[model samples]
Target: MSATAVILQNRFSNDGATILSVAVDGRMVHESWNHTVSTNDARAQMIDAFLDLWNVYCEQGLVLYVSSRTVRNLLKEQQELFDGLLIRDTITGAMFRKTWDVCSASHHKQRREKRPLPSEIEKEPTPLVVVATDASKGKNSKTVGLSAVNSCGIIKTHEMELNSIFDAELSAINFALQQFGKNVKRLEVLTDSRQAIQYIQGRTSLQST
Candidate 1:
């Protein structure tokens, strides 16, 4: 089975940006650098970027290959998401171990034949982020949550409760996207509730505004 891996080069820190490279079969596929003001907040942005990359791989039917270190750090730092996803260090380590073994065997065999290493496989370009929001309302209160994700997983999340859940959910997404700024290549809005998704997609009109 073919696999795509994302290797995080730099550590998350306040001083420098995070760098990530996407590859398949030892070939570099996609690379990007993100400047972060706050390391803690930057994690959400980083996850969003990775999710975008994951969507692209999924489109091509490729399994993800993440470095053991990256997986370990992610588990430690983002325990909530890691636990929710049921990710463990051992699982991630095993994946990397398999990849290393394959690469090593290929390198040793090539040395015997005096042949150049096989060219790295290139991956499809990354996809755009998808935002999903949901809201619920009580007699006098509302609750809302919005998730930013791609094919791979959820990158960022925001939730709150207000008098009107629908309004809160929409507002939450709008505010969250503002942080990303403009020049967003593509976007897809989703909601678990049909009414909310349709309203956002413009299939249904918002009578009030």
Candidate 2:
């Protein structure tokens, strides 16, 4: 596990990649590479590495800690692959500290200093800025809605109806990504349709009727 984590760290992008530490039984077993990659290819590779780490722990009957950033990225890029994966978001300083302590203890290392309060912790990690799109077919009309959110929740919702749900979902995702801008480091999209999720997963391409 240690070696696998080291390899993953090396493969991740250094500039933006979040550090991923893995441990079993309260012991630090692996720490991902320092590099950070934001491109799709990099995200795919990171997912692969994470799966490998997950399998290693599964074989040994141990639980692993995954960062919120990592979870969000995977949720966006490879939602299916992570469907049943045990993931916990370490967003609050207390949560982060607790997880960190678990990892440190796994390796027989002393726990590090705790971070500032949750309020003090930067809101940057939260997907405060988000766009959600949903589609439904009524007896005579189809409807689509676009909504925006910050830390407090939905700030705006727009209604429209495209020919298909795929169109609506894509438009919502695109709009959110655009609105959030490149400066935003994290974004979360919420949808209730499995078809939308599958479409994004590349299992099925969008088709217009």
Candidate 3:
């Protein structure tokens, strides 16, 4: 069992064409493409490299870290191919993508310091600027009411003509963000709408009927 991280980056040729490169543990393990590859092609290439690495190193178990959400989703779709693999997304993957070669030098430091990945670290306590949002719509009415209240006793409301309560709930969240997002570096948003939360978290998509 080992912790292996992979990063996919775009390299520009002398002629200014974008090409894909794959880095494994901050080292350039694959970059043989001479021609530019499409986004899907690049993702395929990265997955191929990952599988190749896994084949060679899958002794006990392997935990893979990757930054690309699309790549992770593709791997998840092919359950049989990655049946025993543990995949995780991390900010360190994106950081390594940006500084592929340079990050290699830091590997020793990371090992010496026993540094943990950013995602592995615990997040700080919640900030004081917490906000709650809600939306109301009358039955068979197109008019929607949106409201946002913060912990500081400030209330903001808006009235709009929208088609669905889902849209209104989302708008209320957006309205809350606009009201306080700029002023605070960290803000906690609370909403009772599970569908809205799912859409916001990218777990589901919103479709207009």
Shift in Å, residue 72, candidate 1: 6.7
lDDT of 1 by residue, 99-162 (tens): 4455444434433344233564334334575655444455754555555544456466666665
Tens digit of lDDT per residue, candidate 2, span 1-209? 22212212222224654444564443455654334546554556656656666566444432324444654455546544543444444323444455467554432321121223567555654434454545444556677666555445546556777776667666666666665545565667776667677877867766633
Q: Which residue pairs in model 1 clash with each other? A: 142-162
- Higher-TM-score candidate of 2 and 3: 3
Residue 49 of model 3, lDDT score: 69
Task: Report the lDDT of model 2 for residue 195.
Answer: 69
TM-score per candidate = 0.30, 0.32, 0.38
Candidate 1 Cα outliers beyond 4 Å, as residue runs: 12-14, 59-209
Backbone clashes in candidate 3 total 0
Error of 1 at 103 (Å): 13
Backbone clashes (count) for model 2: 19
